[model samples]
Target: MLELACISKTFNPGTVNEKKALSGVALRLEKGDFVTIVGSNGAGKSTLFNAIAGAFYVDEGAIRLAGEDITFKPEYKRSREIGRLFQDPMRGTAPHMTIEENLALAYLRTAKNQNAFFSRTSKAEKQFFRDRLALLDMGLEDRMKQPVGLLSGGQRQALTLLMATLVPPKLLLLDEHTAALDPSTAEKVLGLTREIVAEHHITTMMVTHNMKNALELGNRTLMMDSGRVVLDIGGEERKGLTVEDLLKRFKAGAGRELDNDRILPSE
Candidate 1:
């Protein structure tokens, strides 16, 4: 559903601080594929995401969604086809808006009307929103009138996840969406992620620093280093791999020891 061809990005080019963030990085994801990415800081994981999300233009190469070439599309234009969740729980939702209001906004994205106002929301629409919120099993449906700012981090992120997939965009981008939550909450959110993705069959790319999660969560795992994808594993191969196995692959792919202690095994 998504493809990146020979994508390369460099920051502060032609200067002393010129840093190559991506170098000829090519990747492809089929429909319904879930990919988890792992890399140390500066390994170009975020850069790859930003390139696809149009945070910045790549120094070279192309980005395509489905069969459309969106290499030069503005971020807002691309957003219509993409749902993104940031590490910050507050980034995707309006804190002052009630839960129903926020959901109405997301629901409108896939509606023919193209404009949404909670004040004018039909009874059936409100019911739909309520049903969607109920799926989270967080009792949010009971509190649809509550302002989102009143929610805890886990609640907000879960709500954000629902909003992102309210209409099922062509691709879902999750950048450590559970990184900020406590372990128990993180596990809940991740479990929710797996359920939602499987139910909706959403094509997804998740960038996570947790090696264990990277292997355990997605259909495919990508290990990146020095601005390039060094190891890509999937299917049965990925299922049989462990954190220690991935570490060994990283050493072989990058020709260096895996030194980042941040890539830890899950408890």
Candidate 2:
């Protein structure tokens, strides 16, 4: 479970370049909810994720995850409960580290292993890592000794997804994680995301540019613009919804038609 209340953030306040990235943003997520976000550029989608991930403290509001206040929690401390993925495949893993070594680092960094002062690996843990990597079905299990830098973008992204969920954090933040991959590879990674999140009943939020994916992949969809959540749809309201319907709602909430210059890509 997660809750964000009255979240507001401003950059370069009181200056010529001052801009508010998020404004009075509020959201609640129940366990097992997969909410996909759609918006044009500068709509505060990634800002919301960063605020929750402790990339920076919000100028206002509070954030709580799994019953603890993390409003001012340090980024490293929040890592134990929050798992995040970026559009860049190289962001989360060590390029020089072997496949199993990367997995061990993530496995050891989570809350369950937080109390242990020593970062030790055993055969049992390696076997567990192998089993987890095998789930990707990309032959990574057998390539455990290879450095991550040797992998293709899609392979590394899939491996990052596995690492993020190897322990199933309290919440998962995905920032257009598949946007940079080829269509075929992106489809594969998206399928893996659906399976792993469903299997663990993880509460997750994903930022995406593709409108069709926003509607189709997750149980709920949120539309944000100008730093505020403009539309939140789920259940019957979201069922059978079309891209046209979503655009109309965006207009109603944001007091203008969706920006054409920053159009959301749809299939």
Candidate 2 matches the true fold with a TM-score of: 0.96
Name model 1 segments beyond 4 Å from true.
Answer: 111-119
Root-mean-square deviation of every model:
1.4, 1.6
Ten-residue stretch with the least lDDT total in model 2 = 110-119
Cα lDDT tens digits, model 2, 116-217, are: 532478789889999888889999999999999999999999999998999998899999999889989999999999999999999999998888898898
The digit string of per-residue lDDT tens for model 1 on 1-267 reads 998999999899999999999999999999999999998888998788889989998889999999999999999878878998999999899999999999988777656554545578799989999999999999999999999999999999999999999889999999989989998999999999999999999999999978888988879999999899999999988888988899899989999976767666665
Deviation in Å, model 2, residue 50 alpha carbon: 0.6
Lowest summed lDDT window (length 10), candidate 1: 109-118
Which pairs clash inside model 2? Answer: none
Error of 1 at 148 (Å): 0.7
